[model samples]
Target: MLLQETAGSDETLSLMQLDLDDFKPVNDTLGHPAGDKLLQFAARRIQDCLTSDDRAYRLAGDEFTVISRGSGHPAKAHRLAEALVAAFKKPFTIDGIAVFVGTSIGISTAPPDGTNPEQLMKASDLALYAAKQDGRGRAKAFDAAMLELLEQRELLRRSLRMALDQQQFFVEYQPLAEGSRIVGFEALLRWHHPLLGKIPPAAFIPMAEADGMMPDIGAWVLEQACREAMKWPENYIVAVNVSAAEFLTSGLTDRISQTLDLVGLPPERLELEITESVLLERTVNNIDTLNTLNVLGIRISLDDFGTEYSSLSYLKTFPFDTIKIDKYFITDLETDPKSQTIVRCVVNLAHGLDMQVTAEGVETPAQAEWLHSVGCDRLQGYLVSRPLPVEAIGEFIDRAETSVSHALV
Candidate 1:
C-alpha cells in the first residue's frame, strides 16, 4: 500500500511516527528469513521505546510506531528518531548474513496536530516525505511552515489551472551554443500567475504532470514556443520539454507536426527534451514515438542524463540527437571527483552514440574551459547568459554576434 490511515474521533492525542527505508531490499535481495529477522529486530527496538503506559505497533512490513497518552513533544520524538536512524547505521547480521542500509524519517505530533490517528499520521507522513525529498536518511519534524508550503503549492496548482484558462502562461527562450555560436534555444514556459506572482516552472510543472494536466500545459508551451521560433532569425532552433504525462497521451510525431502546422514553424528548427522518467512505463510505445519523431526531422534530447534509472540502457534503445548532462553533475565537476567521473562517462557514452553532448550549468569560466577540454560539444548556463524574453533576445544575440565577429577578425 502507498500509505495507510485509521480514523478516530473525539480524542486528543499526540502521534509520533518513524519510517524505515531499504528495509524491503534485504528480503528482495536475500530471503524472507532475513526480512522476518529484520522486522522482529525493529519491533524489539520499538518496544524498548515504551515506558510504562507507552505502547508500540509494527503497523505493517517496514513501518513501526510508538504511541502513548499525552501531547506530542516533537523535541523528544526528534531525538528518538535520531537514535533509531543511528541504530541502522551499523550493519545488521541475520544468521551471519551481514546487511547494510539507510533510512529517512518524518515526525508528526497529535491532538492539536490532528484530531484522529489518520490525520495525525498523514501530517507526519508529509513530514517524512519532506525528509526523503531533501535526499533521505535523515529525520525532520512537522511544522506549521511545512503545511503552509503545501497549502501554497495547492493554491499554485489551482492558480495553474486558472492561468491556463486565462492564457497567463507564456514561453521564454534560452539559447544553447557550441562555444559562443548559438546552435539552438530552449523553450521555457513561464507562468505569470495572478495570485502567486511569477511561479517557477519547477514549482508547478511536476504537480501538473502528476494530475495529468501536463498534456494541456505541454501543448500550450509547444504552440507558444513554435510560434515564437517563427519570429526568430532563420536557423535558430527551439527546444521544448515534453512532459512524460503528456508524452503518454500525445504521439510525439503527431504533436510536433500539428504544432508546427498550426504555428507555421519548421520541424527542423524544433527539438524535444525528455527526462528519463518519461521512458519508465510504456517503453515499447515510447520507443515507437521516439522513432517517429526522428523520422520527422525533430531533434530529441535526453534531459538530465545520469540522474535517473536506466541511463546507458535507455541510450542504447532510444533515438536521440543530444544528451544533456544534468547541472548537478556539472556545477561542481572541477572540485568533485564523482561529478567529474559522471561527466566523463556521459560524454564518452554520448560520443560513442555519435550524438552531441551539452554540459549544462556552466556558471564559471573554469567550468566552460573544463567542458571544452573534455570534448563537450555544447554549453548552457548563466556563465554564458541567463534566459531572456524574445523582446530582449535581439540585443543579447547582437552583442554575442559582435563578440564572436571580433574574435574571428
Candidate 2:
C-alpha cells in the first residue's frame, strides 16, 4: 500500500522499523501474561507518537513497523523515531509491575532507500542492525555506507567460523594483583586472523556470541586456561570470562568440572567472570547454573560492576565471590568526587557482603594508592601489566612475586 501510494505522488514514504530492547527479561521475570500486557501498552504508546495519517503495524514479536507519508518524510521520520525512543524511557505499568523497555529505531526513506516494499524493508533491516550494534536505545537512518559495513561484517563472520577450526585463536593472561602480590590472572581471548591480522576481543567476541559460536570458543578458553593454570603455583587463581551466551548454555557446570578434573586444576584456583547482563534474562536458569558452579567450588566474580542498573540488587540476588568495579569509575576517581564516593560505598558494601572487591583499569600509582586505601582487595590494569601470552607469564609471575617479596622485607 505504501509503495502504491508513493508511486503516483511526489511525496515519499518513511519506513521505520522499531524493536523493543530487552523484552525477554520482562517475560522471564514477570511472566508472559505480563509481557503480553507490556506489549499492548507499548503498542499504544508507539501509536501515540504517530500522527493520525500514519499507520503502525505489529511486524512480529517485540517488533513494530510504521509507515508515514509526507513531503518532508525524512524530517518527520526522524522526529517520530526520537519521540518513540524518548517515550519508552518511562516505565510501563503492566499487571501492577513497572516494566522498563527501550526502543531501537531503523529508518529508511523511499526512492533513495528503495522503490518497492521488499527493498525498503531490507534497507530498514540493515539500518536496524546498525542501530542495535551501535548499542541499543538509539535510532539510525539508512545510508549506502551501511550496506558496505554489512558486507564487511559478513566477511568477518565467515572468517570467525573458520577461526576455531584453524586454531587461529589464543589466550592472553592479565595479572590481577592483590596489592603488590600476584593473586590471579584473567584470561583474555585474542584472535589473529589469516588476513585481517590481530583482531581484538572487543571486535570478535561479540561477533562470536551473535554467531552462536561463543559456547565452542568459550569452552576452548576454559579448558586451555585451566590446563595452563595447573602449571602455576597452587595458590594462584585463573579467571576466565563467561559470555552470557556461554553461561546460558546447557552443561556449563559439567564442562567446568570436566576441565578441572582433566587438567588436575583445583576448583578453588579457577574463577568465572560474568556481567550483569547475564542476569537480565533466564533468571531461573542463571541462578541454577550459578548454584551448581558454586557447589563445584569454582569462584564467581561479577565483572564490570557499577556500570549497569541495580548493582547492589545483584549482590543481594546472587552469591558472587567477588565484585570488580568497572573501569569507568576508576578513570574519574581522581577528578570526580562522586567517583571516589561511589568506589568507597561499593567497597564497604562488598566487604559487608563478605565478597572481595577488585578495582579495574587502575593506571597510576595515585589511583592504585587511593583504591588500596579504600579497601579494594585486588587491582587490575595497565599500571600493573598488560595482557601477555602464556609463554611470557612465567617470567612475569617471577618478577611479580619477587617484587612483592621485596616489598614485604
Which candidate's lDDT is highest? 2
Error of 2 at 269 (Å): 0.5
- The residue-by-residue lDDT of candidate 2 on 379-408, one tens digit each, is 899888889899999898778877653432
Candidate 1 lDDT, 1-409, residue by residue in tens: 1122223444333355666666755665456888899878777766665666455666777877666453346556666677767876777778887777556777766545775657778787778778877877787777778888788778887777778889888887777878668766898888897665888887788788888788878888898888777877887888999887888895556766888888888778888999887887667898999998888888899998877554477888998899998899987887998888878878888898899998887777778878887889888887677788879877777687655333322
Task: List runs of model 2 lying over 4 Å from the truth.
Answer: 4-10, 93-99, 309-313, 402-409
Candidate 2 Cα deviation (angstroms), residue 390: 2.1
- Residue 20 of candidate 2: its Cα lDDT? 95
- Provide the global lDDT of candidate 1 against the true structure: 0.76
- Residue 315, candidate 1: Cα error in Å is 1.2
Steric overlap count per candidate: 1, 0
